[model samples]
Target: MDELVLDGNAAAGALAEIYGDDMTTVLAECASCGRVDPIGGLVAFVHAPGIVLRCTACATVMIRIVQTPSRTRIDVRAKRIPPPPETAR
Candidate 1:
Protein backbone atom coordinates (compact mmCIF):
# COMPACT_ATOMS: atom_id res chain seq x y z
CA MET A 1 0.00 0.00 0.00
CA ASP A 2 1.04 3.53 -0.56
CA GLU A 3 2.10 5.58 2.40
CA LEU A 4 -0.11 8.44 3.48
CA VAL A 5 2.62 11.01 3.79
CA LEU A 6 4.03 13.90 1.86
CA ASP A 7 7.23 15.91 1.73
CA GLY A 8 7.46 19.12 3.82
CA ASN A 9 6.73 21.17 0.76
CA ALA A 10 3.15 20.02 0.99
CA ALA A 11 2.67 22.34 3.94
CA ALA A 12 4.15 25.31 2.11
CA GLY A 13 0.84 27.06 1.64
CA ALA A 14 -0.04 26.95 5.30
CA LEU A 15 3.48 27.90 6.29
CA ALA A 16 3.56 30.77 3.84
CA GLU A 17 0.48 32.16 5.50
CA ILE A 18 2.20 31.97 8.84
CA TYR A 19 5.71 33.11 7.99
CA GLY A 20 4.84 35.61 5.30
CA ASP A 21 7.75 34.05 3.38
CA ASP A 22 8.47 30.93 1.38
CA MET A 23 9.45 28.51 4.10
CA THR A 24 10.10 25.65 1.72
CA THR A 25 13.58 26.94 1.06
CA VAL A 26 14.41 27.68 4.69
CA LEU A 27 17.14 25.46 6.08
CA ALA A 28 16.57 23.78 9.41
CA GLU A 29 19.25 22.46 11.69
CA CYS A 30 17.76 19.44 13.38
CA ALA A 31 18.15 19.57 17.14
CA SER A 32 18.21 15.80 17.46
CA CYS A 33 20.70 14.84 14.73
CA GLY A 34 22.20 18.17 13.70
CA ARG A 35 21.42 17.65 10.03
CA VAL A 36 20.80 20.84 8.10
CA ASP A 37 18.47 20.83 5.13
CA PRO A 38 15.70 22.77 3.57
CA ILE A 39 12.38 22.56 5.38
CA GLY A 40 11.02 21.10 2.15
CA GLY A 41 13.09 17.99 2.66
CA LEU A 42 11.34 16.95 5.88
CA VAL A 43 8.55 14.47 6.01
CA ALA A 44 5.06 15.87 6.38
CA PHE A 45 2.13 14.17 7.99
CA VAL A 46 -1.14 15.96 7.40
CA HIS A 47 -4.22 15.06 9.38
CA ALA A 48 -7.54 16.40 10.51
CA PRO A 49 -6.12 17.88 13.69
CA GLY A 50 -3.05 19.51 12.17
CA ILE A 51 0.21 19.11 10.32
CA VAL A 52 3.41 17.53 11.61
CA LEU A 53 6.80 17.89 9.95
CA ARG A 54 9.54 15.47 10.87
CA CYS A 55 13.19 15.24 10.02
CA THR A 56 14.05 13.03 7.08
CA ALA A 57 17.30 11.80 8.60
CA CYS A 58 16.37 11.32 12.28
CA ALA A 59 12.59 11.30 12.12
CA THR A 60 12.41 13.85 14.92
CA VAL A 61 9.46 16.16 14.89
CA MET A 62 10.41 19.52 13.43
CA ILE A 63 7.13 21.35 13.66
CA ARG A 64 3.48 20.96 14.55
CA ILE A 65 0.61 23.17 13.51
CA VAL A 66 -2.89 23.00 14.87
CA GLN A 67 -5.72 25.25 13.90
CA THR A 68 -8.90 25.75 15.88
CA PRO A 69 -12.01 27.73 15.33
CA SER A 70 -10.60 30.68 17.20
CA ARG A 71 -6.86 30.15 17.13
CA THR A 72 -3.88 28.55 15.46
CA ARG A 73 -1.02 26.92 17.31
CA ILE A 74 2.43 26.21 15.90
CA ASP A 75 5.00 24.30 17.93
CA VAL A 76 8.57 24.12 16.66
CA ARG A 77 11.55 22.17 17.92
CA ALA A 78 14.51 23.56 15.98
CA LYS A 79 15.75 26.77 17.60
CA ARG A 80 16.87 28.42 14.37
CA ILE A 81 13.67 27.59 12.60
CA PRO A 82 10.91 30.08 13.27
CA PRO A 83 7.43 28.98 14.13
CA PRO A 84 4.33 30.20 12.47
CA PRO A 85 3.37 33.76 13.28
CA GLU A 86 0.70 34.38 15.90
CA THR A 87 -1.27 36.41 13.41
CA ALA A 88 -1.71 33.30 11.29
CA ARG A 89 -4.98 32.70 13.01
Candidate 2:
Protein backbone atom coordinates (compact mmCIF):
# COMPACT_ATOMS: atom_id res chain seq x y z
CA MET A 1 0.00 0.00 0.00
CA ASP A 2 1.13 3.52 -0.73
CA GLU A 3 1.66 5.91 2.14
CA LEU A 4 0.31 9.42 2.15
CA VAL A 5 2.91 12.04 1.48
CA LEU A 6 2.85 15.63 2.69
CA ASP A 7 4.84 18.82 2.36
CA GLY A 8 7.45 19.65 4.98
CA ASN A 9 5.09 22.24 6.41
CA ALA A 10 3.19 19.38 7.98
CA ALA A 11 6.05 18.88 10.42
CA ALA A 12 6.43 22.56 11.24
CA GLY A 13 4.74 22.35 14.61
CA ALA A 14 6.85 19.45 15.79
CA LEU A 15 10.00 21.03 14.40
CA ALA A 16 9.25 24.38 15.98
CA GLU A 17 8.51 22.73 19.29
CA ILE A 18 11.85 20.99 19.29
CA TYR A 19 13.92 23.75 17.72
CA GLY A 20 12.16 26.73 19.27
CA ASP A 21 12.51 28.40 15.87
CA ASP A 22 10.86 28.45 12.52
CA MET A 23 12.89 25.62 11.09
CA THR A 24 11.01 25.59 7.83
CA THR A 25 12.94 28.60 6.64
CA VAL A 26 16.29 27.00 7.31
CA LEU A 27 18.24 26.18 4.18
CA ALA A 28 19.38 22.62 3.68
CA GLU A 29 21.55 20.94 1.10
CA CYS A 30 20.67 17.49 -0.10
CA ALA A 31 23.66 15.18 0.24
CA SER A 32 22.58 13.04 -2.66
CA CYS A 33 21.45 15.64 -5.15
CA GLY A 34 23.40 18.67 -4.04
CA ARG A 35 20.23 20.69 -4.24
CA VAL A 36 19.69 23.47 -1.75
CA ASP A 37 16.29 24.49 -0.53
CA PRO A 38 14.45 25.53 2.59
CA ILE A 39 13.24 22.85 4.96
CA GLY A 40 9.70 23.62 3.89
CA GLY A 41 10.50 22.57 0.34
CA LEU A 42 11.30 18.99 1.29
CA VAL A 43 8.89 16.15 0.95
CA ALA A 44 7.41 14.81 4.15
CA PHE A 45 6.13 11.48 5.28
CA VAL A 46 4.26 11.99 8.52
CA HIS A 47 2.30 8.79 8.94
CA ALA A 48 5.25 6.84 10.24
CA PRO A 49 6.47 6.69 13.83
CA GLY A 50 8.22 9.97 13.20
CA ILE A 51 8.41 12.75 10.66
CA VAL A 52 10.70 12.03 7.72
CA LEU A 53 11.77 14.93 5.53
CA ARG A 54 13.28 14.14 2.17
CA CYS A 55 15.01 16.14 -0.50
CA THR A 56 12.66 17.42 -3.11
CA ALA A 57 15.14 17.01 -5.93
CA CYS A 58 16.29 13.47 -5.20
CA ALA A 59 13.89 12.18 -2.64
CA THR A 60 16.77 11.38 -0.31
CA VAL A 61 16.12 11.35 3.40
CA MET A 62 17.34 14.60 4.92
CA ILE A 63 15.94 14.88 8.41
CA ARG A 64 14.15 12.50 10.71
CA ILE A 65 12.50 13.72 13.91
CA VAL A 66 11.12 11.32 16.44
CA GLN A 67 9.57 12.14 19.75
CA THR A 68 9.64 9.61 22.52
CA PRO A 69 8.30 9.81 26.03
CA SER A 70 11.76 10.05 27.50
CA ARG A 71 13.44 12.16 24.88
CA THR A 72 13.19 13.68 21.43
CA ARG A 73 15.47 12.24 18.79
CA ILE A 74 16.54 14.10 15.68
CA ASP A 75 18.72 12.75 12.93
CA VAL A 76 19.82 15.43 10.50
CA ARG A 77 21.64 14.11 7.49
CA ALA A 78 21.29 17.20 5.35
CA LYS A 79 23.97 19.84 5.25
CA ARG A 80 23.14 23.37 6.28
CA ILE A 81 23.60 25.88 3.48
CA PRO A 82 24.54 29.45 4.09
CA PRO A 83 22.49 32.13 2.43
CA PRO A 84 24.03 33.98 -0.43
CA PRO A 85 25.54 37.35 0.29
CA GLU A 86 23.46 40.31 -0.66
CA THR A 87 24.83 42.67 -3.26
CA ALA A 88 25.02 46.41 -2.66
CA ARG A 89 21.92 48.12 -4.04
Candidate 3:
Protein backbone atom coordinates (compact mmCIF):
# COMPACT_ATOMS: atom_id res chain seq x y z
CA MET A 1 0.00 0.00 0.00
CA ASP A 2 2.81 2.36 0.75
CA GLU A 3 4.39 1.85 -2.65
CA LEU A 4 1.10 2.43 -4.42
CA VAL A 5 0.20 5.57 -2.57
CA LEU A 6 1.57 9.05 -3.21
CA ASP A 7 1.11 12.56 -1.96
CA GLY A 8 -1.60 14.65 -3.64
CA ASN A 9 1.09 16.93 -5.05
CA ALA A 10 1.60 14.38 -7.78
CA ALA A 11 -1.64 15.50 -9.37
CA ALA A 12 -0.87 19.18 -9.25
CA GLY A 13 -0.09 19.40 -12.96
CA ALA A 14 -3.27 17.69 -14.04
CA LEU A 15 -5.37 19.62 -11.58
CA ALA A 16 -3.84 22.90 -12.65
CA GLU A 17 -4.58 22.15 -16.28
CA ILE A 18 -8.17 21.38 -15.49
CA TYR A 19 -8.87 24.16 -13.04
CA GLY A 20 -6.55 26.79 -14.52
CA ASP A 21 -5.18 27.52 -11.05
CA ASP A 22 -3.05 25.99 -8.37
CA MET A 23 -5.33 23.61 -6.47
CA THR A 24 -2.85 22.29 -3.97
CA THR A 25 -3.70 25.00 -1.46
CA VAL A 26 -7.43 24.39 -1.66
CA LEU A 27 -8.95 22.90 1.46
CA ALA A 28 -11.33 19.96 1.21
CA GLU A 29 -13.56 18.25 3.72
CA CYS A 30 -13.87 14.48 3.58
CA ALA A 31 -17.47 13.41 3.23
CA SER A 32 -16.99 10.23 5.17
CA CYS A 33 -14.81 11.30 8.08
CA GLY A 34 -15.38 15.05 8.11
CA ARG A 35 -11.64 15.61 8.10
CA VAL A 36 -10.47 18.80 6.50
CA ASP A 37 -7.16 19.13 4.69
CA PRO A 38 -5.53 20.83 1.79
CA ILE A 39 -5.73 18.98 -1.49
CA GLY A 40 -1.97 18.47 -1.30
CA GLY A 41 -2.33 16.59 1.94
CA LEU A 42 -4.63 13.88 0.59
CA VAL A 43 -3.41 10.52 -0.51
CA ALA A 44 -3.02 10.09 -4.25
CA PHE A 45 -3.02 7.03 -6.44
CA VAL A 46 -1.91 7.92 -9.92
CA HIS A 47 -0.74 4.59 -11.21
CA ALA A 48 -4.22 3.71 -12.41
CA PRO A 49 -5.79 4.95 -15.62
CA GLY A 50 -7.18 7.88 -13.65
CA ILE A 51 -6.00 9.83 -10.68
CA VAL A 52 -7.71 9.18 -7.37
CA LEU A 53 -7.32 11.44 -4.34
CA ARG A 54 -8.35 10.01 -1.00
CA CYS A 55 -8.70 11.47 2.42
CA THR A 56 -5.63 10.86 4.56
CA ALA A 57 -7.65 10.33 7.74
CA CYS A 58 -10.23 7.77 6.56
CA ALA A 59 -9.02 6.81 3.07
CA THR A 60 -12.23 8.04 1.50
CA VAL A 61 -12.23 8.91 -2.17
CA MET A 62 -12.32 12.66 -2.37
CA ILE A 63 -11.54 13.34 -6.01
CA ARG A 64 -11.14 11.37 -9.22
CA ILE A 65 -9.95 12.61 -12.57
CA VAL A 66 -9.89 10.91 -15.95
CA GLN A 67 -8.94 12.32 -19.27
CA THR A 68 -10.26 11.10 -22.59
CA PRO A 69 -9.42 12.16 -26.10
CA SER A 70 -12.51 14.30 -26.22
CA ARG A 71 -12.83 15.64 -22.74
CA THR A 72 -11.72 15.36 -19.14
CA ARG A 73 -14.06 14.00 -16.53
CA ILE A 74 -13.71 14.79 -12.84
CA ASP A 75 -15.74 13.57 -9.88
CA VAL A 76 -15.20 15.51 -6.70
CA ARG A 77 -16.89 14.15 -3.59
CA ALA A 78 -15.07 16.45 -1.20
CA LYS A 79 -16.43 19.89 -0.60
CA ARG A 80 -14.36 22.97 0.10
CA ILE A 81 -13.90 23.95 3.73
CA PRO A 82 -13.78 27.58 4.69
CA PRO A 83 -10.64 28.90 6.32
CA PRO A 84 -10.62 29.10 10.08
CA PRO A 85 -11.49 32.39 11.72
CA GLU A 86 -8.58 34.69 12.40
CA THR A 87 -7.76 35.48 16.01
CA ALA A 88 -7.19 38.96 17.29
CA ARG A 89 -3.93 39.71 18.99
Candidate 4:
Protein backbone atom coordinates (compact mmCIF):
# COMPACT_ATOMS: atom_id res chain seq x y z
CA MET A 1 0.00 0.00 0.00
CA ASP A 2 1.25 3.43 -0.88
CA GLU A 3 1.35 6.12 1.76
CA LEU A 4 -0.71 9.13 0.79
CA VAL A 5 -0.41 12.78 1.69
CA LEU A 6 -3.68 13.97 3.25
CA ASP A 7 -4.82 17.07 5.01
CA GLY A 8 -4.97 16.45 8.75
CA ASN A 9 -8.66 17.28 8.91
CA ALA A 10 -9.61 14.94 6.07
CA ALA A 11 -7.26 12.09 6.97
CA ALA A 12 -9.90 9.88 8.56
CA GLY A 13 -12.48 10.30 5.85
CA ALA A 14 -9.84 9.81 3.22
CA LEU A 15 -8.83 6.50 4.76
CA ALA A 16 -12.41 5.37 5.25
CA GLU A 17 -13.38 6.31 1.72
CA ILE A 18 -10.61 4.21 0.20
CA TYR A 19 -11.09 1.08 2.27
CA GLY A 20 -10.60 -1.28 -0.65
CA ASP A 21 -6.85 -0.85 -0.64
CA ASP A 22 -4.52 -3.07 1.44
CA MET A 23 -3.11 -0.18 3.45
CA THR A 24 -6.36 1.37 4.59
CA THR A 25 -8.15 -1.98 5.10
CA VAL A 26 -6.50 -1.91 8.52
CA LEU A 27 -9.39 0.18 9.78
CA ALA A 28 -12.63 -1.78 10.29
CA GLU A 29 -14.53 -3.88 12.82
CA CYS A 30 -17.86 -5.71 13.44
CA ALA A 31 -20.23 -5.14 16.30
CA SER A 32 -22.22 -7.66 18.35
CA CYS A 33 -25.37 -6.39 16.61
CA GLY A 34 -23.80 -7.33 13.29
CA ARG A 35 -23.37 -3.72 12.28
CA VAL A 36 -20.32 -2.36 10.48
CA ASP A 37 -18.13 0.54 11.53
CA PRO A 38 -14.83 1.95 10.48
CA ILE A 39 -12.64 2.19 13.62
CA GLY A 40 -9.50 4.16 13.10
CA GLY A 41 -7.49 7.32 13.88
CA LEU A 42 -8.62 8.16 17.36
CA VAL A 43 -5.79 10.46 18.37
CA ALA A 44 -5.67 12.71 15.34
CA PHE A 45 -9.43 12.95 14.94
CA VAL A 46 -9.73 14.96 18.14
CA HIS A 47 -9.08 18.09 16.13
CA ALA A 48 -12.85 18.12 15.69
CA PRO A 49 -15.56 16.36 17.59
CA GLY A 50 -18.71 14.74 16.14
CA ILE A 51 -16.58 13.52 13.29
CA VAL A 52 -16.79 9.76 12.65
CA LEU A 53 -13.72 7.80 11.66
CA ARG A 54 -14.03 4.03 11.64
CA CYS A 55 -12.09 0.97 10.64
CA THR A 56 -11.98 0.13 6.97
CA ALA A 57 -13.35 -3.41 7.30
CA CYS A 58 -15.44 -4.23 10.41
CA ALA A 59 -16.35 -0.59 10.94
CA THR A 60 -15.29 -0.49 14.56
CA VAL A 61 -15.16 2.77 16.48
CA MET A 62 -11.60 4.00 16.70
CA ILE A 63 -11.43 7.80 17.03
CA ARG A 64 -13.40 9.81 19.56
CA ILE A 65 -13.08 13.52 18.87
CA VAL A 66 -13.60 15.96 21.69
CA GLN A 67 -12.25 19.49 21.32
CA THR A 68 -10.60 21.36 18.50
CA PRO A 69 -10.79 24.86 17.10
CA SER A 70 -9.90 26.25 13.72
CA ARG A 71 -6.20 26.88 12.96
CA THR A 72 -5.12 23.75 14.83
CA ARG A 73 -1.99 22.29 13.30
CA ILE A 74 -1.57 18.57 12.60
CA ASP A 75 0.90 16.56 10.55
CA VAL A 76 -1.09 14.11 8.45
CA ARG A 77 1.51 12.38 6.35
CA ALA A 78 2.47 8.73 6.84
CA LYS A 79 6.20 8.12 7.18
CA ARG A 80 7.87 6.24 4.37
CA ILE A 81 9.54 2.96 5.23
CA PRO A 82 11.37 0.46 3.05
CA PRO A 83 10.27 -3.13 3.48
CA PRO A 84 12.95 -5.77 3.99
CA PRO A 85 12.43 -8.55 1.45
CA GLU A 86 14.26 -10.82 -1.04
CA THR A 87 17.81 -10.15 0.16
CA ALA A 88 16.86 -10.17 3.84
CA ARG A 89 14.87 -13.35 3.46
Candidate 5:
Protein backbone atom coordinates (compact mmCIF):
# COMPACT_ATOMS: atom_id res chain seq x y z
CA MET A 1 0.00 0.00 0.00
CA ASP A 2 2.96 2.32 -0.36
CA GLU A 3 1.36 3.63 -3.53
CA LEU A 4 4.32 3.40 -5.82
CA VAL A 5 3.82 3.43 -9.59
CA LEU A 6 3.38 -0.18 -10.63
CA ASP A 7 1.89 -2.31 -13.41
CA GLY A 8 -1.27 -4.43 -13.27
CA ASN A 9 0.86 -7.52 -13.14
CA ALA A 10 2.33 -6.16 -9.93
CA ALA A 11 -1.13 -6.09 -8.45
CA ALA A 12 -1.57 -9.83 -8.96
CA GLY A 13 1.20 -11.02 -6.62
CA ALA A 14 3.67 -11.74 -9.44
CA LEU A 15 6.48 -9.42 -8.51
CA ALA A 16 9.07 -10.54 -6.00
CA GLU A 17 10.39 -7.07 -5.24
CA ILE A 18 10.27 -3.57 -6.62
CA TYR A 19 12.93 -4.16 -9.24
CA GLY A 20 13.37 -0.63 -10.43
CA ASP A 21 13.08 3.03 -9.53
CA ASP A 22 9.97 3.39 -11.66
CA MET A 23 8.05 0.48 -10.17
CA THR A 24 6.74 -1.06 -6.95
CA THR A 25 5.08 -4.28 -6.00
CA VAL A 26 1.36 -4.00 -5.35
CA LEU A 27 0.47 -7.24 -3.62
CA ALA A 28 -2.97 -8.83 -3.93
CA GLU A 29 -4.56 -12.25 -4.06
CA CYS A 30 -5.83 -13.76 -7.30
CA ALA A 31 -9.61 -13.77 -7.68
CA SER A 32 -9.67 -16.86 -9.85
CA CYS A 33 -7.28 -19.61 -8.69
CA GLY A 34 -6.23 -18.10 -5.36
CA ARG A 35 -2.60 -18.71 -6.14
CA VAL A 36 0.17 -16.38 -4.97
CA ASP A 37 2.13 -15.20 -7.99
CA PRO A 38 3.93 -12.41 -6.04
CA ILE A 39 3.40 -10.22 -9.09
CA GLY A 40 6.81 -11.34 -10.23
CA GLY A 41 8.12 -11.78 -13.82
CA LEU A 42 5.00 -10.18 -15.25
CA VAL A 43 5.40 -6.77 -13.60
CA ALA A 44 7.64 -5.64 -16.41
CA PHE A 45 4.47 -4.57 -18.17
CA VAL A 46 3.49 -2.37 -15.26
CA HIS A 47 6.93 -0.97 -14.74
CA ALA A 48 7.44 -0.15 -18.37
CA PRO A 49 6.32 3.40 -19.03
CA GLY A 50 4.13 4.14 -22.02
CA ILE A 51 4.47 0.54 -23.05
CA VAL A 52 1.75 -2.05 -22.62
CA LEU A 53 2.61 -5.15 -20.62
CA ARG A 54 1.28 -8.66 -20.98
CA CYS A 55 1.58 -11.66 -18.71
CA THR A 56 4.66 -13.65 -19.66
CA ALA A 57 2.97 -16.78 -18.42
CA CYS A 58 -0.51 -16.71 -19.85
CA ALA A 59 -0.03 -14.10 -22.62
CA THR A 60 -3.02 -12.22 -21.32
CA VAL A 61 -3.23 -8.50 -20.85
CA MET A 62 -2.23 -7.31 -17.40
CA ILE A 63 -2.35 -3.54 -17.62
CA ARG A 64 -1.48 -0.44 -19.51
CA ILE A 65 0.94 2.33 -18.55
CA VAL A 66 0.63 5.85 -19.86
CA GLN A 67 3.51 8.23 -19.44
CA THR A 68 3.72 11.93 -19.89
CA PRO A 69 5.85 13.32 -22.73
CA SER A 70 8.38 13.42 -19.92
CA ARG A 71 7.47 9.84 -18.99
CA THR A 72 5.93 10.40 -15.59
CA ARG A 73 3.35 8.28 -13.83
CA ILE A 74 -0.13 8.90 -15.22
CA ASP A 75 -2.47 6.26 -13.79
CA VAL A 76 -2.50 2.69 -12.51
CA ARG A 77 -4.91 0.02 -11.28
CA ALA A 78 -5.96 -3.62 -11.48
CA LYS A 79 -8.09 -4.89 -14.35
CA ARG A 80 -10.90 -7.44 -14.74
CA ILE A 81 -8.61 -10.37 -13.95
CA PRO A 82 -5.03 -11.24 -13.12
CA PRO A 83 -2.89 -13.41 -15.36
CA PRO A 84 -1.98 -16.97 -14.51
CA PRO A 85 1.42 -17.90 -13.10
CA GLU A 86 4.50 -18.64 -15.21
CA THR A 87 4.04 -22.34 -14.61
CA ALA A 88 1.02 -21.93 -16.84
CA ARG A 89 3.45 -20.83 -19.54
Candidate 6:
Protein backbone atom coordinates (compact mmCIF):
# COMPACT_ATOMS: atom_id res chain seq x y z
CA MET A 1 0.00 0.00 0.00
CA ASP A 2 1.04 3.57 -0.61
CA GLU A 3 2.15 5.70 2.34
CA LEU A 4 0.52 8.99 3.19
CA VAL A 5 2.46 11.93 4.56
CA LEU A 6 2.27 15.61 5.52
CA ASP A 7 3.85 18.18 7.78
CA GLY A 8 3.08 17.99 11.50
CA ASN A 9 0.90 21.09 11.40
CA ALA A 10 -1.88 19.07 9.86
CA ALA A 11 -2.30 17.03 13.02
CA ALA A 12 -3.01 20.03 15.21
CA GLY A 13 -6.73 19.53 15.42
CA ALA A 14 -6.46 15.87 16.25
CA LEU A 15 -3.82 16.50 18.89
CA ALA A 16 -5.89 19.26 20.42
CA GLU A 17 -8.88 16.96 20.55
CA ILE A 18 -6.84 14.50 22.51
CA TYR A 19 -5.01 16.96 24.76
CA GLY A 20 -7.84 19.46 25.23
CA ASP A 21 -5.69 22.31 23.95
CA ASP A 22 -3.70 23.40 20.95
CA MET A 23 -0.35 21.61 20.67
CA THR A 24 1.00 22.56 17.28
CA THR A 25 3.00 25.45 18.63
CA VAL A 26 4.90 23.29 21.06
CA LEU A 27 8.55 22.56 20.30
CA ALA A 28 10.09 19.13 20.52
CA GLU A 29 13.60 17.78 20.20
CA CYS A 30 14.37 14.57 18.41
CA ALA A 31 15.96 12.26 20.93
CA SER A 32 17.96 10.44 18.30
CA CYS A 33 19.41 13.42 16.46
CA GLY A 34 18.94 16.18 19.03
CA ARG A 35 17.55 18.51 16.39
CA VAL A 36 14.83 20.65 17.89
CA ASP A 37 11.79 21.85 15.98
CA PRO A 38 8.19 22.70 16.46
CA ILE A 39 5.83 19.79 16.63
CA GLY A 40 4.08 21.43 13.72
CA GLY A 41 7.21 21.19 11.66
CA LEU A 42 7.71 17.46 11.97
CA VAL A 43 6.59 15.07 9.27
CA ALA A 44 3.37 13.21 9.85
CA PHE A 45 1.75 10.12 8.46
CA VAL A 46 -1.73 8.82 9.08
CA HIS A 47 -2.55 5.19 8.51
CA ALA A 48 -4.79 2.37 9.64
CA PRO A 49 -2.91 1.80 12.91
CA GLY A 50 -2.65 5.44 13.95
CA ILE A 51 -0.68 8.65 13.47
CA VAL A 52 3.10 8.86 13.29
CA LEU A 53 4.96 12.15 13.70
CA ARG A 54 8.60 12.19 12.73
CA CYS A 55 11.47 14.60 12.94
CA THR A 56 11.93 16.47 9.71
CA ALA A 57 15.64 16.96 10.27
CA CYS A 58 16.64 13.33 10.83
CA ALA A 59 13.50 11.35 10.09
CA THR A 60 13.39 9.92 13.58
CA VAL A 61 10.05 8.91 14.98
CA MET A 62 9.16 11.56 17.54
CA ILE A 63 5.60 10.91 18.43
CA ARG A 64 3.18 8.09 17.85
CA ILE A 65 -0.48 8.33 18.78
CA VAL A 66 -2.80 5.38 18.69
CA GLN A 67 -6.45 5.63 19.46
CA THR A 68 -8.58 2.64 20.20
CA PRO A 69 -12.26 2.23 20.93
CA SER A 70 -11.67 2.91 24.62
CA ARG A 71 -8.39 4.74 24.94
CA THR A 72 -5.63 6.79 23.38
CA ARG A 73 -1.91 6.20 23.75
CA ILE A 74 0.77 8.77 22.94
CA ASP A 75 4.42 7.77 22.91
CA VAL A 76 6.70 10.73 23.37
CA ARG A 77 9.57 8.97 25.11
CA ALA A 78 11.69 9.24 21.99
CA LYS A 79 11.02 12.96 21.89
CA ARG A 80 11.92 15.80 24.16
CA ILE A 81 8.49 17.30 24.74
CA PRO A 82 8.60 21.02 25.17
CA PRO A 83 6.44 23.22 27.29
CA PRO A 84 3.67 25.21 25.67
CA PRO A 85 4.75 28.37 23.94
CA GLU A 86 4.48 31.59 25.89
CA THR A 87 1.22 33.44 25.39
CA ALA A 88 1.25 36.93 23.95
CA ARG A 89 -0.46 39.47 26.08
Winning candidate number (lDDT)? 3
- Model 4, 4-79: lDDT tens per residue? 3122245444333333223232422333223333223222333344444433434344333222343222222122
**Candidate 5 lDDT tens digits, 1-89:** 22443444443332222123323343433333333333334434443445444444444444444445443332223343334233322
Instruction: Give stretches of model 4 more than 4 Å off.
Output: 1-49, 68-89
The per-residue C-alpha lDDT of model 4 at residue 80 equals 24
Question: lDDT tens digits, residues 20-72, model 1?
Answer: 78999898888999988788888899854799988888888888888778866
Candidate 2 lDDT score at position 48:
90
Q: Cα miss at 21, model 5 (Å)?
A: 11
Q: How many backbone clashes does candidate 5 have?
A: 10
Quantify all predictions' global Cα lDDT against the true fold: 0.80, 0.79, 0.82, 0.31, 0.37, 0.74
Would you list the rank order by lDDT, best first? 3, 1, 2, 6, 5, 4
Model 2 C-alpha lDDT per residue in residues 1-89, reported as the tens digit of each score = 15588888988887776675778889899989899888888899999998999998889999888887876667778898332223200
TM-score of each: 0.84, 0.82, 0.85, 0.25, 0.34, 0.78
Candidate 4 global Cα RMSD: 13.0
For model 5, the run of ten residues with the poorest summed lDDT: 13-22
Q: In model 4, state the lDDT of residue 13.
A: 44
Between prediction 1 and prediction 5, the one with superior TM-score is 1
Global fold similarity of model 6 (TM-score): 0.78
- Candidate 5 versus truth, CA RMSD in Å, comes to 12.2
